[model samples]
Target: MAVSESDDEGSDRARGKWRAKKKQRPFWQELPILIVIAAVIAALTVSFVGRPYVIPSESMEPTLHGCSGCTGDRIYVQKLSYYWGDPVPGDVVVFVGPPSWNTRYQSIRSDNAVVRGVQNFFSFFGLVPPDENDLVKRVIATGGQTVQCCDDQGRILVNGKPLDEPYVKSDFAWVSGQQNATYPSGRVFGPVKVPDGNVWVMGDNRNHSADSRAHVSDELQGTVPLDNIRGKAVFKIWPPGRIGPVRAQDPQQN
Candidate 1:
């Protein structure tokens, strides 16, 4: 049971040498390790915590601006909100487009496998757009609610109550000649009962947006499944003049 001072000193010297070796590692070697760690963290953040999305169309205009030949608004979509509760009416959200809605969506990736692989890697870091058909819209009705267009005052009704949506930017010209426009789009549809676990969504730009209304004949009755929702768009982070929190006004609230 006797421990010698020489043995203890040898053990101490061995540990010191190892520490010195670690400290002497070249920056070039450490750089790769740091890069891999950072990449893993970025990937996880993009997958679960939050990610940035660029608005690709005018559908959410006056709320989120994106159009041809313009700087699109880049929004930060936070996944944490839905982890606490389901999306409510008026929450702006990003979701993968359903099959019916993606009929016209074309992937921007090149056909070459090597190029596509490079594109995929860059996309993981938010350097390039994702190849999927992702869309952004506002929740109009949730599971169990019946949504329909146009009261006498041209308002959308959800569960027999008219929604007061201040964010809507309708093409009033579409209804100009109508005697009493039933809806801003000048087209009437719905009274569609949203299936449980699905949400009826629409764009603020009613006349132009090909949202759930445009896909009503599809298998899911145009309602997006909750599972398709990527995240709640919490803030607009691009176009310095337009930077602000994305509104999540509950249209159902009186």
Candidate 2:
């Protein structure tokens, strides 16, 4: 059938209208949409895959630096590792502070709902520090193992065997401003057996760390439940000069 001239004109006009309706959105108008999309994707990545955490103290010093008047090291904690296996002895992990560990914690989060929501969003990208009591430490002993500090050579023992912890730094002359502030070894603690699904952790800056050893009097004997662990710290992502893979050296190997 031969097409009519009027029919052809009508089709052309319809096409023109469709094209006008589908014109590219202005860059400024599209930017907010782009921002929202990026934020959602980033939030999901931080929630399920990995996230960055800034060291808040000297607890894991030398191995992971954070202290007054110093640029804190930001670490990447990957959640996938723990999904396949539990944290083993020597694994550096980020976890929520248990009840006992939070006695001295004071959250910096704002009480105002609007301000807190803004903080929560920025926290995902690490612009703001997390307000919760999150801590990082090395696993000294896993479930069913007995952990205690100090042997004849002043070594921490797990399962009655001394751990050769090369990462431990008892000296703090660089930050503490005292030449004699170093401890020959970490403070002594119990031979408490870690409960099932729990781990005993300690900071690499042994003498200055308020880790599991400081909470032995707690109900769980200071061992953190495995469920409390956020993830294994895989890499140091900040401080250009100090970036490197965070070591999970097996202290029990010795």
Candidate 3:
């Protein structure tokens, strides 16, 4: 009788342990569902909403920089900045350009594309992936306006009004673009009017950027169509040392 009773107690103890083990393994069983939900949420976020963008160029200079140059690291771009209004002058912006930038990224990467996507997910949350590449530059002129550089007093002019460009050249170098370039190169413009739905843009580092000031094929030059504007870059939020409001170039300058 004693032996039989002892055997029954051991059996009960084993059953208890089995139940405990099952409870401990709950997350493993539910993991697939959890992953599915997470993936669905991510897809929606990337498709319908803002994804964090990383700057990877010096095209914006004092405004933004990517790892490709001396500017340290990446930043989170608000993809919805243009939903309320068009890009205005002095607004920093990001946009996809010609294959010159994207092709180079493809040539260098060797990792699996899925892994890259996962890394980007972490970047979307501003958590990891300390690197990115999106061009950032300041907008200079909006639609239906005339932009010209070098007033009689060494300032830029927009629609016959002089802009107070404290962030740009007071006597900043007026480096000209290619001889036939449509941008305001070397203070050159026969008063070309920005088209009805385009905005003229120039980098704060006017001499260097290949922005709207750069060539957009043969027919359209000097102005970027409104649809091409990804979003207006508002401020620099990285490096933790330099952060402040991106000031406009005195829109009231007349």
Candidate 4:
């Protein structure tokens, strides 16, 4: 029969090219492994589920602003909120520099300490990308807690109470409207007690901050030691219509 209909039309054209390569071979090998597992789960949800910061400085005014001296507010830094404890009292942080303020926002991957220890271990698996010269403040007393500056409406007491701070900077408070304010007079003097571990920061643009009030060698200092803090400032993703959520102004004490 014409060689059995040409071997049954060459076995039905080799079974329709083996069912079109078993249906396009899993849409091209699982589309690049599902795009590298959705880019490592969106870089571990932007490294520890929350990231974005862009407030160059104005220290944090009326809750945060920027641009008169440059580098103003554009904040968001809440990587799993201190895992569950530690930095409190109006918390707004982003720290990891005690080689003396590590050269103001000095990027370029912190001049590679083996790429900052493999970007702090894949920044805990966001797969890497973080460290913007580092320095962002807020958190007015922790550890042994005492932080003082003024009490009678000159405000700034914490552990002695009085912290209403609507995000100060419209005639400052937290004591320097006559605190005898002679820093280095006792090395960040005052009722300043926070020690036992460390943590006592301030800057709602307190008259244009110089945090911890000058003296880590006096450049722009104000006691920050809880291992140079590194977390909190819950949210403010970015101008995609002012994202949302940002907390830590004593959100239940630390």
Candidate 5:
């Protein structure tokens, strides 16, 4: 069959129109939709999947650090990990700060509703530092377990078994001569048994950390309810060299 010139001209016009339409669309015109999609994904990730958290203190030193004026490892807490599974001993968890946790509410300003509303919005994506009302610590003992400091050899005993705590930070190296005798505070804690549904949390940097030991006077004896745990710290996301799975003491070892 012979091709018609009109057909060729019609196809050329259609191609020209399509090209013109493509040129008419500006990148900025679609930017809002992209922004919306990004915001939604970030919100969902922070809310129910994983959330980034800045290590706020040296309490988890060697594992995580928030040394004053120093860069700390930023971690992603696996919020979905415990949705169907229970938190076990040795999991590093982020949880709501107890009333006695930190008296200084550094990020909390005047109790203005509008101000709080804005803060909450930014906190959702972890854009700003988390409120002082949040804390991170390692689970020393879960429900029905008894945690005590220092066996005869100066090791933390959980459920009567001495933990192989390679992560516990050493005190001043020069102190010398039976450090446990000199530092009973870190070496000798309670024979306290964890109550059902509660878990005893402590900082890995024992000597420097104010954890369950500091809160023993409270009714709950510093054992946070399992329900209070937000999630487990699963990975280090920042500090490129430090990026890897967060070291968690094996719960099965307990």
Candidate 6:
């Protein structure tokens, strides 16, 4: 059957109007929903999967830098790694500082409620550093193992054997005896045994780090409980040149 010209023209106009209305819907109307979704995903990932941590001090130098007055490496610490297993020797990790360890670093907190709230909001998504009382170091000795300073060649001894410690800082001044006059003193610490459920940690930059050895007088005797550990540091994700896996060295290889 033949359709009337006027009728066909009316149908075409209706289709065009529908298309225009669809295009006219404001994109801003959907923006808030998208932002909420993104925030939820970020929050979940940070809480359960991983998060970025910026090196804040030179304690873990050469392996992970936080040198004073210099930019530090940004790494992703896997929050779920320790869920199924405990932190073993040679695993770089992040953990909450013990009360005894807390005195070493000055707290950086704002008394203003608004400023503190703002920082807390961003921290939920791993956008900023965690609290000042958090620290990162390599696991040197697990429960039941002994950790001591300085073998015959200044290497740390673990479980009655000297560690290879290829990652240790070996700069000219350190090797020449001009440096390392204090901390790594050839026989500075005892052959202390790690207590059950705790792990002894130290920084790769021995001379510069205030680690387990420095906190021996504390109640935990310089060891952190496994429960205090946040997770293992797995990757360096910043500074293109330094991007790579944060190696977990095997004690057996040394």
lDDT of 4: 0.63
TM-score of each: 0.87, 0.83, 0.65, 0.34, 0.79, 0.82
Clash pairs, candidate 6, are 57-66
> Pick by lDDT: which candidate is best?
1
Residue 112 displacement (Å), model 4 = 7.2
Summarize candidate 5's per-residue lDDT along 1-254 as a digit string, tens digits. 99899999999999999999987868899899898898888888877887788886888888887888888888989888788987887889998867777676576644898988888787777565556577889887888989876566666788888887667775323322344433325455677888898888878887777778777768887788877788999999989988999877864473
* TM-score result, candidate 2: 0.83
Off by over 4 Å in 1: 1-22, 172-185
> Scored by Cα lDDT, where does model 1 land?
0.88
Error of 3 at 96 (Å): 2.1
Q: Predict model 5's lDDT versus the native.
A: 0.78
Better of 1 and 4 by TM-score: 1
- The true-structure Cα RMSD of candidate 5 reads 4.5
Candidate 1 lDDT over 117-211, as tens digits, reads 99999889767778999999999999999998767666779989999898986744424334442443455668799999999999998887988
**Which stretch of 10 consecutive residues in model 4 shows the poorest summed lDDT?**
213-222
- Looking at model 3, residue 213 earns an lDDT score of 47
Task: Tell me the TM-score of model 4.
Answer: 0.34
Q: lDDT of all the models against the reference?
A: 0.88, 0.85, 0.60, 0.63, 0.78, 0.81
Across residues 54-167, which tens digit of lDDT does each residue of candidate 6 receive?
A: 888888878897777777898899978788889988899999888888876764556798998888888888776666577899998899988875555556688778887777
- Between prediction 1 and prediction 4, the one with superior lDDT is 1
4 versus 6: better lDDT goes to: 6
Q: Give candidate 2's error at residue 239 in angstroms.
A: 1.1
Candidate 2 lowest-lDDT run of ten: 173-182
Better structure of 3 and 4 per lDDT: 4
Residues 149-200, candidate 2, lDDT per residue (tens digit)? 5566666688789889899767323322222212333356687899999999
